[model samples]
Target chain A: MTTATAPAVDSVEKPGARERAKRPGTGVGRPGFAWAAPAAVFFGLFALVPLALVVVLSFTRWNGLGSPEFAGLENWSKLLDDPVMVKSLWLSLLLTVLGVLVQTPISILLGVWAAGHQRNRAVLSAIYFVPLLLSITAVSVLWRAVLDPNFGVPSQAKWLFGDGNLFGVQASALGVLVFVSTWQFTPLHTLLYQGAARAIPQVLYQAAQIDGAGRYRQFFHITLPQLRNTIITSTILMVVGGLTTFDTVLILTQGGPGTDTTNSAYYMYQKAFKSFDFGMASAIALLLVLVASLVSLVMVRLSGYDKMRSTMEGV
Target chain B: MALSLAACGGSAASSDGGSDTIHVLVYGDATNKVEKQLVDTFNKTSKVKAVLDTIPGADYQSKLQTVISGKQAPDLFFNWGGGSIKPYVDAGLLMPLDDFIAKNPDLKSNFLPSVFNTAVVDGKPYGVPMRGTQPVLLFSNKKALQKAGVTAPRTWAELLTTVKTLKAKGVTPIALGGGDKWPTQMWFQYIYDRVAGPELFQKAVDGDKQVWASEDSKKALGMLKELIDAGAFGTNYDSVKFTDGGSPALLATGKAAFELMGSWEYSTLQDAYPDFVKSDLGYGTFPTVEGGKGDPDNLAGNTNNFYSVLKSTEHPEAVAEFLKLMYSDQFVKDQLSIGNLPTTTNTPKFLDGSANPAYSTFQYDLVKKAPAFQLSWDQAFPPAATTTLHQAIQQFFNGQMGTDAFIAAMQNLPAA
Candidate 1:
């Protein structure tokens, strides 16, 4: 009897138990679908319905007031010839790249350094989180005021530096817009990166340092690799945010000075509501969604979400 | 679901169609005072209740469109008639008020024929004119005008001379709110009418002539360039909000000598500076072009506000009743007294006689005297072209593109 029990235990320890769990409708199989039904309903109603409508509308013409008429790929065809829309798409793409490439690195470095000082971490996090807490409208209004030619920071700076307004130059104006956007967003990225940096095990750093690795080398060799999933997620979110940016641009510039800073979202709004070309607006929105989805899909594939999930489970 | 929906439907119906309640959407906060007085008086005198639903002008059009297209579009909602109402009317969203108009001899007789004509499209009257606003002359600081030694420009030559004089004084001769594209376009349209005359302007509106490419348009553009060279606009004018631009700031501060804004600007002034209407304000039409067809006295404004009934209504009579209440003597009196120029042919004698004196002058000349009206450029053009006009004007003023390019771009705008 003891020998038979030992054999059964060994069989359970073998990969057979894992295979059984993987089988359909087993112990670790799909749980009661009741738990998922609510979420599925929510996603269906809030996300899929609108997305499906948008996709359908992309193939039609609607004035937002009257019934839509099917136009096949006419909206898509028109998109190829729309210079204003093309320009907006390019700007949104550039903003996304800037958010990930330029903004992510600085935020990660700042976040890691800030995370090192435990005594002041809470206060520092709060400081970094302040911009995120402010409403988009509030943030935009604040920046607009600060960037005003007659009474803003740049104007005062010029006076202090001996001159009239410093806001007239194109480069200066562009710089202010970029600076305001980055300043408002960097803190949020920092908070995300800081959390990622903290979760990195101390043992890995210890072993690296004991082997004569410098702090920077330890970070590069161990800490950075551990934060791969976090970095990817944060960068994706920031890029998405950058691509859809509207309120700030609207409040600050209103796509004015001859459409200097018109983003895709604002362009969509101007076309649909302002000009009453709802069909064209839907086309623009569909294009935006497509581009964002492609970018996210590429990031997900490269980052190995399954591996990241396993690592998260190990923690 | 059935129970809840039934409950909601019952409550909504009771709240909406109940006697003693008539809902009306008013345009802006400034009109809320007058609108409410009318509503209150109507409610007090009759069992039919009247309520004012005032929405900010910025969000009014979009919101109104939404309401009209949905299950509820207030019993009677304010409409800026003409082209803006065309889409709604064409969609069969608005109830034709012809039957009501035919029945009510009082409203028919009270309104000016020209003003009433705007509410009629495709042989159907969908709305009734509440007010008639025309372009009124405006001057900035008396000090600036005195320094320029020009009283007020009565003709094209005098305008140029006065502008030059003001420029010589290092003051902006004209404070055109180029930031608000509509104002700049108004100047162009006014000049175009002056150069091409009312008949041609009518032709232009009918799409028979591409006015943007016409000689009158060229002359108008040249005049704009002249104004631009003379530094007629405020600093960073392209960035200014419509309300905050040249009028309230530059004009109020006396930084500029004159403006050619709508009569509504008077209400704005009254809000900005107390006692403005009573004493400080004056009005005139756009100066007559030297050899143009439009008379200086020939007006370029339409009824800026109209109230329409929804065609979806189960109670068309109620909707008409609400509109009738709006045109009632008490209602017209309250509105007219409060800066609004009532559409009434003879505003009830009870209405305050202190009508915005400047607007009253234009109203007398245009609504009472002018031969025919050239509706506002925005009000006359299709929505797509109208939008193009705004952006074209903005780019033109921003020095982004030349006037020829601007006009050419406008000609290429998609027509309905």
Candidate 2:
């Protein structure tokens, strides 16, 4: 080919060289922009944009009918002194604690039991996972009927509490909410824990038994140490899930017998939908995100996650 | 790409559902069939066709607001009228119906004035009644009351005595759906209207912040507290909701002898407990308190649902035609067929042959002669205020707050 024609061919072959040169160093060796472009665009469109908008919306007063107006500290200031907000925050914290203290132990035991019982595994797993398969509405209705004071199990057990309804009284409402939530969510944690438990070498348990270690000793020294990372992760999931509990509480008590079970997530929902105060709701949402982040950080430190990471790096 | 997509649909332009066809959105449920029938009847001869759309009842309100603020708002929509459309009215998003009324005077004159006035916001009509009136009434499961040696009470004293008698027989005196919160608010609305009178509610809704703390209001609170202390609703009423069928089941099984429910209770019972409905159901108006200023004939409940037009609609005339269909004789009959007690002046003639003739006639007469009817408080006040109002009412009923705290909470309701 002639020289001029070859130059023309080269220009066509290497199009947009100027644009390519504008990017950071060694751009060509990295995957082409088009490779991750779809994911980046989708992520930006859905997750990042919504989160950014929520932050912006937190500073405005929008009634969802009219244009949102800038109201610098109005929503934040109102949230600071709000009694419902304070009560809801406490309630959410209580739920997170309950999830850790109650649901974790149940999940661990179930996971351990499921690991040993190969013969009954199918039936036991099916029974445990029923709540996950049932629609939330169905579960809520079932639980409501089961707890009904006039004709439910409470009536037959009248001699124990003497016609006392579990869900009606304010003092018991929070406990009932926690119990119902744990009942529905324990299977999820069980599945998670079972994965970690099953991964542990069977030889280790056999070795511990030969070394005169009991089943409990084997669990504490071998199984628990091996499952530390999984347990930490499960706790984090439970705590965050606890903070955002909504549907179960809403369908069961509607956050009441007078806000007795009003978690912060449900509180934010009420502020947005019931009151049409989107600004306040967004503020509550951002507050929850911040609190959850701080809590996760503290949890990791307390669980020796940093030391674990350092040990892995040293290896 | 997202920006471009939004930009393409940004203009208030229809993608040719036809310039002659404008959509009407309504909350979906059993009532949708009646709405469709009426729309089909209207579409047959009209120049501008009306298309009906429905969102499930649970998500309707939130979805309506989202679509209104976004790009998909309907030309016309269903609403509970008073405070439901207030924000839209304030934002100039709704078209006032005054011109339509002026052009068609029968639209105003055909329905009961009390029911039609529900859509009046700031002295201007923004909505037209489109369905049946739902007046709250006293309902009894007859055999249970008979077992207790009591009848449906006509006065508050007799009601208290009946509660005592029912409790002695191990029956819950009233079936309350406190979990939903709105049903519990019905008791407050009726008691307040009977004690402080309907005007007090009107004034409170009109932005009189001090109205909730008035002497009559305090007195009403006291009487409500006395009823709660007397165990009229039973200890577990807060967890039982009609929406979930818990409270209604209580009434059906004779665990609850009395229930103050909307007139829809007639249809609900007819559907769920047909045999019991035939053998043991009875109804009455709310009982009056002694020395109360309000007339004994006054009632409290939802008047009817309404259709309001969007200001951005291209087919105002089409919306006008659709609204006019709401008052037609055909509309009245359709409402009656569903066991609804319509508020149109012509509704009375069709009642004798409705789904439940006796129940229909009872409600029709109850609403017709009532000197006043209090629209449900949650519907009467601003929609944004409803959460606090519901919270306050629930707290008071659960005995979480004293009378003063309840008064304070009511006074702080968001301005209309």
Candidate 3:
């Protein structure tokens, strides 16, 4: 081939060298520019841009319509004195604590029982998972019907208990709600605990039995210690889920009978969508996220998930 | 090369030129065959091909707003009269029909005066009213009334008396679907108008007077409380859906004595009871309160739906032609026979009767003799105000706030 033709071939083979050399910042020739582009774009747009916008918008008074003005933290300073926020925050914590305390032991007991029974385990598991199959709205509606003072199991229960029509508030209503929630979510924790329980070497239990450890003793020592990680994980989940509960509370009580049952999430919906106050809503959302994060962090630390593997490996 | 290819894949389909297609969005099931018949009639007669895309009524506002903001809006769509269309108007997303009306004077004159006014906002017409109806009378069952030995409630006192008697007879006096936030406000607003008088009610909704805390307002809330206490709303009141509540079980089963519903409810009841059209169905205004200024004849409600053309349309002329077809004389007659109060000035030839006897009383009260008409409170106010009113009603019902506080909260709300 002639020299000019050879130059043409080189041009074809190695295009954009001059262009690449002149590129700015990370530079075109470097792997950093090519590799970091997607992540950089994502982090900048999603994380940094939104965070900046939220911070700026937090101060401004915009009613989710029209252009927002630079109100200079007027919304933020107003957040300090909002009574709804205080009530909602307390309500959220109360629900979380109540849910966890009520649900955990029932889940644990069911988990332990099911672990020993192999024949009906699948059937039992399916039965336990039935609640998960129903959508939150459907579940709320079902429970509402089941707790109806005039038509529900409570009225039937009243008849059974001889309390009859004399009963004022259906005492069974709150209990039924808690029980249904546990029934719905317990299967998840049960499976986790069951898996963890099975992982405890059968030899350890056998050895403990041989060494004069009674069933209760073996349970307290070997079984409890072995399931610590699973319990901590499940507890964290239940606590967080309960803290952010919305659909059930909204559909069931609508924070009704005078806000007797309004949780923070439902309250936030009432404030935001129902009331259309984006500023107050955002403040509540941020507060909720902060509280959940702090609680989850404390839980992880107390559960020793930081050193969970090391402790497990040592064991 | 791959990135560009993916971008190409993500791109939306662009409409080619000369397409005769016009998209028309509606909400809810075409309640009757009226909308379907109208659309079909337009497509057959007109050059423009119109397609109806129906969304649930509850989600229509939010969905339409998104569609408009994204600039993928339909050619023509449904809107509530003028007030609800303001949000879109302010954004310059609605076509002004003044020029169209000027070009077609006959079409402009076709609509009733009240009907035409609903489409005019800021002295410019945006929507064309299709069918109008008043929500004045509630259909009541006489069997339940006779058993309770109570007369048809003509005043607020008579209504409460009926409630007590119905409870004694083991029937629910009234059925309300509080699960729908809008209906809860309906009960509150209905009482608000009846007790405070219609002028004050309109003034409050228009941001001129704050009536939420007026003695009349307190009386309304107190009346509602009385109903709740007397078992008017029934158990699981919060769980009932609106469409299901006002008609199905309440009017059809006869277990409930009265349903505070709109004129369209007559058809629903007829569907449930074959003889409903001929026998035993009585319609009247919400009863007046003792010593209250609210005239028994004061009205509340609007025609069912309005149609507006999108500002981004390339075919404004075609939209005007389509609206003319909808509001024309022939279309008006068909709609009126089916119990729709047509917006057009077309006279009806009713084989059944020129007057829908059950609805005429309320219509007369609304159109002729009524001193004032109170718009649906939610539809009348801006979104923020609507939300505040909803919350206030809920809070009041839950006993979270007293009547004075509720009024103060509404009175102090920043103007839209």
Candidate 4:
């Protein structure tokens, strides 16, 4: 009764509490959606329309040089029997697993290192960011030289890839491909982690310190929990990125030494460009997109990304 | 961007009806200059202006596919004549040159029959042979062979001896660009024709599956496996690519002994090792297989590039006039000036005028006297089979797959 008596005097909603995104059409109304209309239109035209085209093209036998023949369910059924295609999907999945397992931890460690040594952060970041500056083609070419049996690290040292040169030998090709990719991409993920860590208020760490929390204790009780959302987002990014890894494999291996390193995206490219079978390529692509989307969704659900975001927004 | 798209649509008949601009698309390379010059020369005399478009070399085929299916298809375009034009032929998107050839008989009679016939699908002509013939030859370093105390091999037994002698002297016996699968295919194509003869491929092309799964095909693959097992190409052949100049660099550095390459190797050597070309670069035909029924003199390669007209062209008369230039004396001279051995009837006379007359004459005589000219398997098969055929060739060379697998792969290719 006391709270109700005070509320009738002034009824004004504060900013940022108008979370229209959470409960649509429930927030304060102002200007129309003209601001977002252009972006939505472009997203439909450039992204959504092309995606639809690919789905439609999957049902036909398109050589990309003539009229696409309507093959009904023939192309989709063929994917089941394509051993090379199936193997490529598996390889792509393997790369994703390795990327997440290796790249995520390294990025988090880098972020942690950057935080404690604030004076050297700029210098450290500059070093880590070097790989991110190089183009994928350049990175592939550089790594190819580094792994070359004739005059590379393997040539001098005999242990690394001398057992098998990166591209020529099956056992090392996939690993070398992953290594090259991780080497090139780790910096970007590290930057993301660093940015996320920086966003946390310093008072939280001070309060934890004042409670006699050690560094390890603070990291476990504060940093890791605070960085949960960042970790989930980075993991999702890395997973999806690994699924469509093409340039490194294309330049380094050409998916060769007999399909040992052909991932799903490269496999689709091969189907389209090398085989000129657009229908089959499109089918493979759609399947990969489905797997990628499903994986990201599952990861998000398991990490309670939506629930955390909603709880945080409710404040 | 929308304006350009509208322009493209408005000129959907850019080649067909309204526009006088007859679009001509060719693969972009060092050859684009010559193509442009030829078009300029044509444009000077003709009312129909030939607008040339050159797509980058790496993306040529894919871009060609896009343009052919899209609104910007050329009135006339450059192609490898065989499998490249087959799909368009089947689709009836191409204008058969029967009527055009009837008007200008030289389009058929001027070019080499086998070379000219590559563009002829299902007994009808669809294109005119434009560029020069590119027959595959076994190129050797004279110094390497001399140091190894061996001569250029002329038979399968001699090749094995050369390989043995070269390997013993610590030289890579063969400089194969296995990384670029087509170079590996040269070994298969020559071996297949040498062992099984051209009739087997011809029968396969004529829809006889028995030829692909035949004993002869298996034997050819067996010989290839033996070559691989013998360490003829050394341990790292798959890492070397011809297109990137890696294999050629190996040859230039004297790390490798011989390279089975095309007639273009002369120009490549000229570019890379001009002095070495004079002193060391020597080429010969693919050696004969022992007890093979195929003619030892039989040659295998790309016949030449061609200029095919689209049925969508507005000015057939103008395109026919331009095609006739493919056989013109001026065209022959221009082609010869660029180290091209044109496949025209007049090519023999113009040989002395070529950039490398000796090399040109040698290639000309080789093509002239060959009992049969087997079109390259990739060029002969449907475009869809190129990847499968190339993979099979590489797998066989690398010992990743054996004779049975190779035969099965070839057999599974989309039928000619």
Candidate 5:
């Protein structure tokens, strides 16, 4: 079947290429640079322009009241010297790593299980997806109420929550942030893995079963390896989303008790909006952009996701 | 691109001042109804019409800063006074109301002195008191106090005894919303005021960094430490918040005995637990600290919200006319009807007409006679310092920061 279709595809493509070459102005089956103009213009206007302005603003001193005055690396020097800034970066990284570690396994297992043709799985999956439907602000507010030490679930379950100081201490606050993110985002990742798991060819599993491979062995050998690209994609999304988390921190903890839960994104917002130090905030923002891009680039490189090689190449 | 952006800003600013109307920007909340009414009253007789614009409460400050220097600048804008308007004053964006006051002394004389002085910057008045004063008071659930076999404390010694009594009764002595951070800072403000008098903070905010390490400061910290060591606020105060109705619920449900909160607590409780407010809510001035330098009559919290004029307003006469309404009999009644205790001397005349007459009268009498009304430290310092101030406060209360470390943080705050 492959051999028969190979030449047929070549014949179809060759005539189309020749016809296009014969009448280039017709532009049939080909998109010109003009086709991308709108998107390019939009990106330049919204993303690149503001980014460039932020870079410039990072070198200045402005408190949102007047014209920015060029201060020549003052903001950068101060940011480097700021202990909270350093701490915030580590918190951001910690939350991101924890999110990836915790959410990956649960999403993978749930996705694979839901990929089965079972009514119960579908029902449970629908229920699990409820958190994804709520806005981040709503989710944070809801969790805050639920975790209130005196009036919330903690008071009723003292043995488990132990005073329900989830947002009072640094470790627990960080844990709450990671847990909330995982709870809110896992459904989207599970959906991704479900699609990927369903696409895993059934013949491979059938052959493995015929060879006396158990379900666990089949999952480890077949499903895990088949979902590599999807794992990489999901991880990259988690990495970026984790880095730029703002609303949750703002609503749940406000970067307290005493800056314990102050992540880089929240710190940037505090500087920009709360403190009204736009120049310093711009510096923090530019640093965030650089860090996010570098981390993603390294991830893509390490995973060989940029190579775009298919897992089913030999199938 | 930057130049074009600047040009756009310049043109926009010029266009805003081109009209005959004076725009009044206020923090949008329930009180905006009264502001709109005042504007309507001003527009009734004036040829130069008054326009009222509102930015939602949370975004008001940031929005004001962004537009205050540009074409979108309001002819007059609402502010919390003190450090809230300092940056604008420094930027020469605000009009000193001395000239307006020279023509209309009622703008200064009509409001309570303590409340009016909050808007004074650099020896010149910059704001007119508009909203009600919000002094921090010791609010208690009367039922909770009775259950604990204690009344509201009148002195530091009495407060400690009450804490002990309340704790022995298995009730948290104080319902502190430490998670909000600012609520934690309120304790510092009241303690510092009661122990060291308002001068220590005044000097501290006025660039005397040494005051944070002064003997009186240490004494105040020690007193606070004593209260904390006695577990006055219980163990999980840091996990509760006032904004989300956590600490208030604790008080209302009789799980805790007292909450040091702003005058707004009355309104907040009235909204959520009306029965509790009517029968059980009790309020009083902060307990006096024995042998302390501060006056017993000293107060701390938001003094009041003020309407400050922009330096570039085309119609100062119309703006002045608008400000005159702030102290008018109608303004006081409107403010009182909404449960706000306006600081106007005329406020006493309409006390009978207030939503809660007794509560309004109590607040008015306290504010009227107070020798010193210190604004909240966060508001007394510039906005940039608020984050550090709040963090230091939370850290100290939670024992995450030592006294010395907290003092260092305080000293590091950007000057007012």
Candidate 6:
């Protein structure tokens, strides 16, 4: 009876094997083009189509009234001459770099520590994850209230805050922006690293222990190496998120104290909604998209992340 | 995509020609109930129904600009009535209200002339005043002023002295919501009006860029600089915002003695700190600048909100009938009940019915007596110029931009 059933199962599998052999690149259970069609269509309709229109709008003069008139690179030329535009680009880069530098180490340390199997670590990690649940607008408004000069935290801690004029100056305002973003977004990056850390094989650490490696040595040799891909993934997210940061600047600063905190994203909003210069805003938007894409691409290439190799490949 | 969906909805609603409804769009806020009531009143008498639509306040201007020329355009819509509607008027999307006024003269005459004239563009009436006038006033916490041994100032010199006195008492002399930028612009509007008179701004807005560099302009900047140098607003005004209740809270709590804001500040304060508004709030017209060219009673703020008709509206007669309600006695009472000081001729008769009778009477008298009511500079300029204008105002106040740089920025604004 067993031999008869085995032959029946083999006969059923033989046809599937022949089909797989017929199209060698089409592996068993792999989805075809039709599987991705929905997502692709959605992306085209929402993202690609709007991006193409924004490109077209960059070359046209539209005040959001009537139809757009072709202006023949006028908006682009104007942006080139705009000092605010130049300043905004630098500000965007500075804020993004600051965000990465500030958030990465903290996230990594927290993530690695939280990956432990202790009960207290789980509780603390849950508490730390609270910020990630709050909306960006809610986070910004909370920080704005907390940092208000006369009414907020600065008011209570006079010695520390020095009259609580944080938003009055450029440096402190930028600092507050970076600090708030770190406070809100570090949890998300930490979660990424935590998941990655837990996935590392216990055998590697056990082998390191057998070799008389200390905790620090084991972390550096085994854990750090394991988290390499996650670090890249997290940094890329930080880079993109920093580039498009808007709600925080809007609710907290409105790009004020004389355009001190006006990053590219906020500046684009100002041009589009505040100034009603859709043409100029479209130009800025296109530049941001290009810069973000180029940065992400360069980062992937530099990290060899696009190669899709596993961190544990040699092991 | 959402905008397109709205456009489709709007077209679908209006495509049925047999449907006897005229859409009336307004800026959505607590004030919408009044507009809704007014529309109900219009629909009661007319064969054509009046429908009220609102875009939330912040998005109102952008949404209006997008839909004004589309199939979604309303029959009549809310506007600030200066350069706010200039683009639409320039695009010929707005119908000049002269024809409506010609048929019913009260449409032009029932509202205050100054408030009504704000809607006149290129020598033609395009809007009728629908909402109240909001003249900027110097508001104070009386308790704070008493603690500082000072009264609300009546002249520019007295104001300076009051600031010094308030500062000596460890209070922020003036609560400038510099973070909101436009609140900062209120100072410029009053200062420029007093120092150069309304004609200087009028010339500047009418395409004479040279006025921004005129000696009068420099002198106005010098006076503002003197005020700033006096530490009148304290060092941290840029960290405060009235919209967020930061600066207003300062005034309410007696941490600050003064806030120069629009008449709307009364209601804002009432909402946030009713006790402070009831017991301590004191307001007066902006102090006179001695030897300045402008009249002391001249005002600067939003003149009034107006309803402008779309040129493509299918129901003009229905819209005109609806506008007539703007000046009716009930309209004035309803507006006053909401703490809005309507600019209709009959507004004074119902002042006692206002949420704050004394405040209403004061504002009514101020609006009536003012020689010139200068619209806020950001509103006077085309929408395209607001960011540059706001940035310049903020930079100038914060010492980020020098006088010459501010002048250049103003000169570079797209001509109204």
- Model 6 TM-score (B-chain only): 0.97
Task: Check candidate 2 and list the clashing pairs.
Answer: none
Q: Best candidate, lDDT-wise?
A: 5
TM-score of chain A of 4: 0.85
**Candidate 4, DockQ score (0 to 1):** 0.36
The residue ranges of model 6 lying beyond 4 angstroms of the native Cα positions read A1-31, B1-18
Clashing pairs in 1: B20-B49, B21-B49, B22-B49, B137-B284
lDDT of 5 by residue, B1-416 (tens): 34434454342233354688988888889999998898888899999988888877787777677777776778888899999999999999999998988998888998899999999999999998889999999999999888767899999999999999999999999999998888888889999998989999999989999999999999999899899989999989888999889988888889999999999999999999999998999999899999999999999999999999988888888888888899888899999999998998888899999999999989988999999999999999999999888888888888988889988988889998
Please provide, for model 6 over B227-277, each residue's C-alpha lDDT reduced to its tens digit, 9 standing for 90 to 100: 999999999888988888999999999999999999999999998999988
Between candidates 1 and 4, the one scoring higher on lDDT is 4
* DockQ of predicted candidate 6: 0.65
Q: What is the C-alpha lDDT profile of model 5 across A1-315, one tens digit per residue?
A: 344345435545675755655665543443446667889999998889889999999998988767889999999999999999999998888889999999999999999988999878888989989999999899999889988888788889999889788888888888888888888999999999999999999999999999999999999999999999999999999999999988889998889888888999999999998899989999999989888989999998999999978999778
Candidate 5: list runs displaced more than 4 Å. Answer: A1-31, B1-15
> What's the lDDT for residue B13 in model 5?
32
| lDDT (tens digit, per residue) of candidate 2 on A84-168 | 8989888899988987899998999888777775897979787988887777667877888787766677778888646656666
DockQ of each: 0.25, 0.45, 0.15, 0.36, 0.66, 0.65
RMSD per candidate (Å) reads 6.0, 5.7, 8.4, 5.2, 4.4, 4.0
Per-chain TM-score, chain A, candidate 1? 0.81
Error of 5 at B170 (Å): 0.5
- Residue-level lDDT of model 3, residues B206-232, one tens digit each, is 576545666677777788888777777
> Per-residue alpha-carbon lDDT of model 1 for B219-257, expressed as tens digits?
777877776666666445554444443345556656567
Interface RMSD of each: 4.6, 2.6, 6.9, 3.1, 1.5, 1.5
Q: Which ten residues in a row have the lowest lDDT in candidate 3 chain A?
A: A163-172
Q: What DockQ number belongs to candidate 2? A: 0.45
lDDT of 2 at A81: 91
Error of 2 at B167 (Å): 1.5
User: How large a fraction of the reference contact set does each model reproduce?
Assistant: 0.25, 0.61, 0.13, 0.37, 0.90, 0.82
Work out the TM-score per prediction: 0.83, 0.92, 0.81, 0.90, 0.95, 0.95
State the lDDT of candidate 4 residue by residue for B6-96, as single tens digits.
Answer: 3534522244558788888887887777788888999999998988877777777766765675567889888887778888887778988
